[model samples]
Target: MQMHKNRPKNEKHSRTVMIRILTCIRPHTALVALSLLLSVITVVLTLYIPILTGHGVDQIIGKENVDFKELSAVIITILACIAVTSVCQWFMNHINNKITYRVVKDLRICAFNRLQVLPLSYVDSHSSGDLISRVITDIDQFSDGLLLGFTQLFTGVITIVGTILFMLSINPYITLVVVVLSPLSFLIANFISKRTFAMFKKQSEARGELTGFTNEMLGGIKVVQAFGHQDEAQEQFEEINRRLSGYSMRATFFSSITNPATRFMYSVIYAGVAIAGCFAVVRGMLTVGQLSSFLSYTSQYTKPFNDITGVITEFQNSLASAARVFELIDQPSIAEDKAGAVRLQNPEGHVTMEHVSFSYVPEVPLIENLNLEAGCGQRIAIVGPTGCGKTTLINLLMRFYDVNSGIITVDGQNITDITRHSLRAAYGMVLQETWLKAASIRDNIAYGRPNASEDDIIRAAKEAHAHSFIMRMPDGYDTVIAEGGSNLSQGQKQLLCIARVMLCLPPMLILDEATSSIDTMTEIRIQKAFEKMMEGRTSFVVAHRLSTIKSADMILVMDKGHIIEQGVHEELLKKGGFYARLYNSQFSAV
Candidate 1:
């Protein structure tokens, strides 16, 4: 009952996905038309061969009656037709491959570009493995299905139509027998395909789930081993993998029924046509040569049905994968810059947040009515416990996430009114979670200022205290960083990130535990270098190590998303309030 109920919905979804896939092929309309034309030529030439063979048979009634001259001409003409058909089929396949791959390439580029503009929140909520599966694995499956459809579908239809016409001309009674039995094959195929589509959809989703689970475990394998949870992680992975296998088996089972079921019906049609044609020949209504041609036409007519039915599994999987891909590309992108939005130019490094309210989830409040100001060239330090909205504040300032109810401005201009590119360009940032591309150390340092001179890059590296370690490597400045910087120590990676920011020297700075990985001595040296860099730029530093921020022009003590206390180092210590207690707790041992 449930299977019957879902048939209409499944059919509708399949239709929609196919329509979208066709739109991708629209740019190659000329190729498609050419393919159709070639299909007609190929089918017509191939179908004509059987007629020539029948005629050749008629010419050789017996040894004494045989016409060798006519028989030789028919044989040559048959060979010519076969040769032309093969050439046309080859050309048709080449065009299909070209169109299919081009569409797949376009889809991949669109998905990747969509990722660039997707809001950070969406990335936070979706698993990276699932996204990767859609882009890579699913697209490859779609390409295979599309190529098969193009290769088989055009010629299949033409052959079926051409064979039916040729058969009707040969013997109407045998053709009628073939046509009557053909519908049963289609009915059987239709029933199985409807069920298979739903199964394949579930299978695709399970594959994505398994991918996400595997990715999560691998990314955190170190943590899992350190905590002695290898058994638990493996058990969870096995569970997801088992589920995926079950879905795949069920989808395959249903789809596999389609081909054999249709073939059985096609065999019956062939038997029926053969019997009817033999009776007609016995009744003097058909010739022996004509009966042979009718039999060949019957096989040709049913071959298309068998071929189309055989590809139903692949076609369903492709449609399922296409749905997932389209879903991602259609997701609402991040807000675009407003009309006539101004670009932030020569920013004065004065930033202000007024009455800002924000929450990652609506029911759970995080930050509320937050107000703060940083004067030009002032260094403001933000200190708070974990999950106390310290990073969220920085996100708001940089427009990574917009505030719900209030405005954040840079140099008195609302950040929302400024183009995000130019607004973010005004600040240099180094966060605790460092990111480095797989490129030379020189390129990593010059990431922010790609055109910076070699001397400038070396100076920034020296300032970040990374030059000495870099020089020891085999390629010095040209040493290529590995993917994820696995070849470098955590401290070395952080240093390169800092050097990147140093090279930029933007008007504003954000340091979120920027020096946390380095040892105390190097951190002290880097802090001194940071001081020189911040001499004339407003800097916002979020740190858990309170000792590093003592010289900040103003210190903000935050708790529960509000500023509980704000003062200079001397004044905050004298007051013995939240700021004093936090400061004392860190340096009390000293």
Candidate 2:
């Protein structure tokens, strides 16, 4: 289950998310300040047009002949205001976009930087597709909504205030009438907005699930086709895709209705104000020009209701994206390093585990009270059936995971007492599953030892039996591999990984089925190289092929998270225990 499962579905959470967004915006203070100042100028200039038009109307009222000079001045002033308003509006949009995009870039960088420091367990538990969505898709959606909401949000506020003040100066009674009916637009918008927030949240979740499914399918496309499971995979993808479409439809439908509904109510308010103004005009209580200006003010005041309601509609989607992003940022990570931690330098690789116990979850331990030790420069080989905790032992030794009880130590000092960087740096590891990024072969080989010389990188590759195929390529060492090195064979990728570890040449080595992909003939040929690399180094080997581990200094047979047998190869066979049975079962088949 995801930690995001019990999301805070309350107003406080939404407010907090918005506060975070504001924090991002606040960093670019000059841009936002300028945008807001332009917005105010634009709105004030727009409101001035109506006031001038009202004065022109009063001048023409009850006149046998028009005052040409006054009329010309009124028209000139209105035109000048429109031109200035256009310029201010243009600058306001430019500044808003600059602030919005800069804020979005900083937010994405923060999310990516957070992932770099997060513990490995959190990465293991979460879906890759969902994290990608939060970093890429969700941030884009959230920023877009923020841009739309804020741009109109500021202008809408200023228009409302300016219109209200001008209307009050003209006639407070009519202004009050407009004010009372304003809440009707808000009421309808509130009713619709309440239903939309949850719908958008669900839609965002379904989108991430669909994205996850697509990534999984593509990454394993070869297996899916080889096993003839195409139809099954297609069915599963369609199910998730259809679910995403349904949630999107519901969210959009609710958002779409907000603008039209608010406009409908505004139109009703407009009609009522016009009728009331006519009576005032006929009774000589208000001038014709004032009535005309009052009608215009009524329209302007009511228009903001529609703009604000539209913001309410779009805010739902932004809120949904924000919640997902925060969920990832809020996941509990493994405890940080203790203050004043020690660093291990030139470790002798004297590893020991005493009463160590651990589990992926509590109450059902995977390794319980297991005790083990390996002297400096001893080669330890661990053999077991699937799920017998062979790999779990190595994980504990490296402190990839901390043991629930008991301690693991190196060179007589507790592993936890050392800085993680210094602790992990002591061991050179090569796993069964190879990892290669989109970089030159030489760069990948020298990843750990970045300052390694060209001659040393080639020497390591030659020892690992990877030099011939690499040289056959047109670009040789400079050839860039695609992500995952899809063009390379399984054995080739594994050999490259081995070459990487050999180049680093750390104090200790861990080979987890390291060369399982190589053929028996190839393995026999590379045995000399393996012997050379493991010389005088504490090496732990986890191999399914019993032949590869026959010469280990110490052989451990594990079953159900316990050490079932321990001895040299000949002695273990003499006992005819779990180790003997496992070894004989493999050779007998051959």
Candidate 3:
């Protein structure tokens, strides 16, 4: 996989970021509004308890005489409000969690769908591990921030605003002191928040790197052991782990500082409010009940500030995840089918490449103005050294990558003018690496045709000469193979792949070194099966074994992306050219 060396850094808190996030929530606006309403009720109930306590104190001091019935009603009303608020809080949390889950689900689906439409070049340039991290880990981080941090921030803001308004109505002098301390608290929070944001971004990036490293290591463990590089791999893992630890520590330390600084600032503000309240009480500027109420409001005002700071820290972490996700979503896709692109219907297997020029990268052409033609049902064999553009030829024929210059056609229709889905659906491919999922042998065979019946799967398997061996397994066709068919032999896996393509029954077929891994004996046994499978289909083979393609209708011997010779086996042998030399080398060994 190609590595992206320069991932962009998210340095500023842009209004655009907030706007994008809000756009994701557009579908869930109703739920968000309901949650906001519940948050309001929670804030109101939270502030009322302190006021009710102050009233009870006044009643006990005989300053505000209350009858038993009125006192009982007030107490019951306060308690009832608290209970309702608790219920509303639960309801809001449920809605928040639900919305977050749905949003993440939608985002993941969108990302995956976009991946499908993206070009093979794009996928080749991005690591599988990094892409997976963006889809899974980053989206989850966004969910966490939305569900926990956003909820707290909303409730805190409402509480702070409501408390300030009530405190001013009770006693203006005390409210003024509380208001002055707000900026100091904010300044401290702002400083810590910036540091936390930077650390958190690093921490998230480190996590993705670690995940990619671990995945690469585990996937190639056999290679590591065979090469005796286990220690090297271990050291690499240790380095990544240490880096992750350093970033985590920095993020945690900054996150930890925010709360304490907030608490200290709150303490200083409280001391000042207390001193001022005492003087006002002595001066008869405030009543005991009013002073007590004012003090409660002042302390509660800091609750919102603390809550906002905490939420801000969490939002910073979540933004890191969002940045990764957005990067993927914003990536340019391969050119799509044009406005009037038509689907190929019942395509003839005739294929032509005219003056084709192509490159995986600019300035390094893999194939240059190459021309070739294959009639319907013709078996074409391509022979070349490694990296001589044989596979690149197949990639272009399959439309996995478009040519830089020139045209490829199916039945006289330009492939570029056809829908990608329709173009690919016309061909069946058996790659060198036969990838089998963790599924039953029957299911694996039916993968090309999900709705195919049991009999159809059995027929395809039988045609590929896989049924006899599959029947010998403990569960026969029902036997489940490990991922990548680890439980099966290489020949067995190749046979399954052949069976899958046979099930698809496309008019055109590609065999990309498909039988290279199978033993000589298995190859001999399956040669007839392959011949039968190739019958009446336009077939293209990238040959590793010269004998396998000796019977091909046309053999194209290639060197350095150019066709050096093209003829039937006997005709090519008579020419004494590249094909003749290749045939002599393989048969000379025999």
Candidate 4:
């Protein structure tokens, strides 16, 4: 039931998100500027047509001397302007779409790159599904809302201002009513918008939860099927789906109320305009043509308010998404590399933990001032009961988590003084849970050194005893592996992982229960490969199999995060310590 910790929260709404978003569009600023100019022209052209119509109506009704040719010219000019506006609108739409796509592309890349630079702890504490939702869903929402809302809001404001100014010039009294009603429109918009924003925030959170559930369920489908828990999973999924549906409905319902409520207020204002205008026309306070123009202007004025209100709603929704996006972007990054931090060059891979104390969380210390050291070219085996901090030691050595107290050094260089990238690059790791991408076997094997040639890949694979099996497959090295190497046997998968680590050819190697799941024959094959790979390299192996570490230069038996015994396998056995007891227990049973 652990939730993702990296989930975004709305802290404060600043122009910062928009500013950052606009920076990505700076390359397309020319196109954007042109689009904005065209949009303005379109609004102007749209407003002028009503004035032309009013003039034509006056000519026909009041003068009773319709200059048909002049009227035709006016109508044609209006039509021409309409055509121009349409063309401009089309171009604007194209530019906006292009800018939006580019911005989103940049945002995605930046977000992904930032994710890479973040520490392992960040990834460990977050769910892949929730992060995926932020990158895919939240960004998509921002893109959709931004493009539409920017254009509509700009044009709407211009139209509203232009119409109001024209109306005031013609009939100040009627304009007064519109000016009074505008504030009321804004008030209603603000009220509805607050509700919409809340609903949208809830909707976004629900979506992340739903996505996380999908990822977890799909990733563990094999386990679910093995346990015959499909129905139970379905029920759990259905419950999540129902909750998502309810939240979505609430958001939609609140959003739906905005348009109708705005329209209802506009309707009242429209009725008032009609009645007031009619009275003015009858009393000769306003001419028929003037009244007609005023009515047209009133409609134009209302349109922008309507448009603004709609944009406000969209803005609210986007703010919800932006809150999530910014939340991730603003997360306190892992300790950054300091200026002038020295690089560990030609590392000897002689690692030492000096009174290192650490914890994943504050309450529980996984490694308590644990002291250990591995000389260059020495093979160290760490054996312990499960959760006795064996793997945690490796994690610390790899600098995945900084120690709460004390220091870890590699080749006399404090790990904290070196860049994480540089420090990690010096080590090769083969984890117990081998992770293979859905790619060709050759690609998987050569993943550690992407530029490695076919010869290099084959050499590495051959050393791990994986080359023969790979060649015997349907497509040989080109055969595609399934996710997590599901198509291969566990032993074969482990061998491939070893081959990948071999390709890296680092001076330090970590093998975390790498041979635990393999058969005896495969284990023997890999054990030789590991011994060969560990040659002239500082190596740490965490294993339950006592035989694997019998030849290790040093063996440390750990219990409850403390190293209780240390020596060569025979030396520890002669000492009759914890290591001896564990070794005897297994051999005694056999």
Candidate 5:
């Protein structure tokens, strides 16, 4: 009952995806029209071959009275038609290939562009591997399906229609027999197509899950090995693999049934046509040559039905994959900047948050009614227990996630009133998780300030205490870093990240465990460099180490999303509150 009720919606969605796919082809209309013309020419010329064969046979009318001259003319015409048909078919296929690949290229670009504008929340909720599968694997499947449709589908339809017309002209009674049996083949194909589509859809989803799970496990394989969870991971992988295998088998099994079932009906149609034509010939209503032509038409008509049924499996799979790709392209993107929004210029670094409230999940409140103020050039440090919203606060200030209520302002102007690009441009940030591209050391340091000269890049590297080690490498500044910086040590990667921030030297700074990965001696040098850079900039430092922020102008101790304590480090210790307890515990542990 549920399946029957949902069928219309499923069909509607399939039609919508198909329409979108066609729109991508609209740009190449001239080529498509050419392909169509070729299909019509090809089908018409091929259909003429059967009539010529009948004429050639009629000319043979008993061996002694045979008209060899007429027979030779008919045979020559048939051969000429065959050659022309082959050429047109080749051109048609070439055009189809061109159109199919171009559409696939357009789809990939659209999906990738949509990914850039989509909100971070969407990315966070979906697996990276799953998204990759949609953009790459799904698009490839759609390409194959579309190419098959173009190459065979158009020619097949033309053949079917042309055969019916030719048969009617030859003998209406025999054409009736062929037409009646045609619906039986269609019914069989329709029933199987529905089942195959459902199965193929599930199979595509399972394939995505398998890709995601494999990516996740491989990315964290070191951790899995460290924790000795290889066995458990293997078990999980096998489970997903089995599910994918089952879905693929069922889909293939159902699609395979389509060809045989439809072929049986087509065979019945051919037999009916033959029996009817034989009777017509005996009644002197049709010539033996005409009966021969009618039989050839019957075969010609049924040939397309067989070819089309064979292509149904691929077409169904293509539609299923297109639905997935369109789903990604149709996702809601992040809201655009408000109209008349002003860009922050020469910001004074004065930041304030008043009665701000936010939570990742609505039911679970993380931060509520938070109020704080930082004066110009003040170095404010935030310390909190794990899951106490330390990072969430940074996210709010960066506008990566907006607050639920209240206002956050920079330079006495609401941040929301400021363009996100300009607001973010005013701040330099360094997080514990350092990211480096597959580029030279010089390029990595100059990422934030891409136009920085060679001298400036070197100066920034020296300030972050990374110049000495960088020079030791074979290529020095030109040394290329591997993806994810796996070729560099943890401390070296962190130093390069710090060098990036130093080069930018924005008006405000947000350092979240910025020096967590460095050695003690290098960290001391980096801190001095940080102090020099933060001299006139408002800096917000989030740290777990109690000693790093001792010289901070104000230290905020947060718990359960609220600022439970705020003062200079010395004053906070003297007050014997949450700050003192957290500080003392860390000192004692060391």
Candidate 6:
């Protein structure tokens, strides 16, 4: 498995980002085209008003008196134009919002589905909070940005093009002034966009960090309060929040300057065109009606500059968000079951690991040249000190990770050749740490075998000695558990987890310090339950408590990834080797 110590940087090209975003919109092409067409129609109606007003002033108004008829006609025409423009604008927004949200929805779903199939190694190394932020927070930002960008960019382009044509028809000199000042707006937008993009990227990252820290702290809130870390946690969160606020302010500060800077240029050119128009009228080079029309057209032409710049300024933030979502989607998934892979059906539960070698990191080998065999219904107990590759071996057996070399086989068939679904289904596991959902006791127990009958679920709970305590809850099996099963004691949570595995009824079982959280009294009941459950199933019991595994058919004593001794407890103690020493030391400490 490839592991990255550092998070990947958002380095997607702007063109790549735009293309991906466009591709998302491509599915709703017909709706998008209609929205753009409405934008054009809206612009046309708007431009028509200026034309009718210009004509009324030039031909119908007398110098000494106002022409109410022509003025009324122009006013009526402008009002009609506004009514149609508003309707078109509303419908266009409706379409754009639909298209934008649909695209973001699809993006979020794809990213989430990808997470389900991603390698456990990657999931393990990454922060859940940051991943959640990317899935929810970043995608929402992308949608907002896209919606705004689409509305502005579409109308901005059409408005600029239409206004320029009208202004040129009235007077080219005034149009020239607008054209010349236009680049300054873009230049300012361009400069500010580059700076804001970087600032906002950092801001998004800071938000993710803050989110990750909060999630981590909340998940372990009990420990935090147990040690009185409330103030420390608050202070740390404030530091991150403060840093995020600074980035946010800086990004806002840079982006906020864009509109005002462009509008300042617009103001300069607006006055310049009006002043130059006055001179033109006095020189008889342009008429009063024409100059008036030209001034109106100049404002229209320059208004797009404001919008386009504003869109450009805000678009950078969306681009930053898009880059984050796409980066997550682009990670490689774990290899699927091989072609022609066989399903692991009912078996006698013979398992073997031949010449197995593995390392979490390439430079550091944790297990080397390991070989093991267990026949059907054999009970193998694996005992070792911490970090001795005990759990790592179990991880391989479950195919959570593949070995660096050699073969893991069941019933003489290589596990790699078995469909992972069926291969994993053959084994039931109860781990050291119990994980329960915020669900009812029944649902939590049924999680292992969703189709299990109610009687079976209850039976499994009874076998794990959880049914009596469960009945005392307000709703018995229907009683809802809190997150991480916090509503139940640690032993109660473990019992539910064990009940879950018991319901699976697989040919093989894994008890990886499964009773670690249970008190001595409950542990005795659970161990008895394990005996009945493992009657005809091969079981690998990983435990530190030597007493628990004293009756295991074969005890494999391990140190530094190598099994140094194998026998029943008495035989191993009689050898007086490393296993004997460990047993003595563990007992002496107790």
lDDT minimum window of 10 residues, candidate 1: 305-314
Which portions of model 3 show Cα errors greater than 4 Å?
1-14, 62-71
Q: Candidate 2: which stretches are off by over 4 Å? A: 1-9, 56-68, 285-292
| Deviating ranges (above 4 Å) for candidate 4 | 1-32, 62-66, 285-289, 482-489
Model 1 whole-model lDDT (C-alpha atoms): 0.91
Candidate 3 overall lDDT versus native = 0.85
lDDT of each: 0.91, 0.87, 0.85, 0.83, 0.91, 0.89
Candidate 2, residues 1-590, lDDT tens digits: the string is: 33234344545567778787887788888888788899989988888888899889878846586777898999999999999999999889888888888888888888888887777788888789988998888999898888887689889988999898988898888788888888888788877876787788888899888888888889999999999999999899889988888989988898899888888888988998898889888988789888888888888887777888888778888888978887777776667777887999999999999999888879777888899999999999999999999988888888788889999999999998988889989999999889998999999999999899999999999999989999997799999988999978889888899999989989899999987999887788666778899999999999898889889999998988999899899999999988888888988866
- TM for every model, in the order presented, reads 0.98, 0.93, 0.94, 0.92, 0.95, 0.93
Residue by residue across 264-352, what tens digits does model 5's lDDT show?
A: 88789888888888888899988888888888888889889888887888888999998999999989987788889999999999999
User: Compared to the true structure, candidate 4 yields what TM-score?
Assistant: 0.92
lDDT of 6: 0.89
lDDT of 6 at 184: 84
Residue 406 lDDT in model 5?
92
Q: Rank the candidates by TM-score, best first.
A: 1, 5, 3, 2, 6, 4
Positional deviation of residue 188's Cα in model 2 after best superposition, in angstroms: 2.0
Structure candidate 2, residue pairs in collision: none
Best by TM-score: 1
* Candidate 6 runs further than 4 Å off: 1-12, 55-66, 230-239, 285-287
Q: Candidate 1 has what TM-score?
A: 0.98
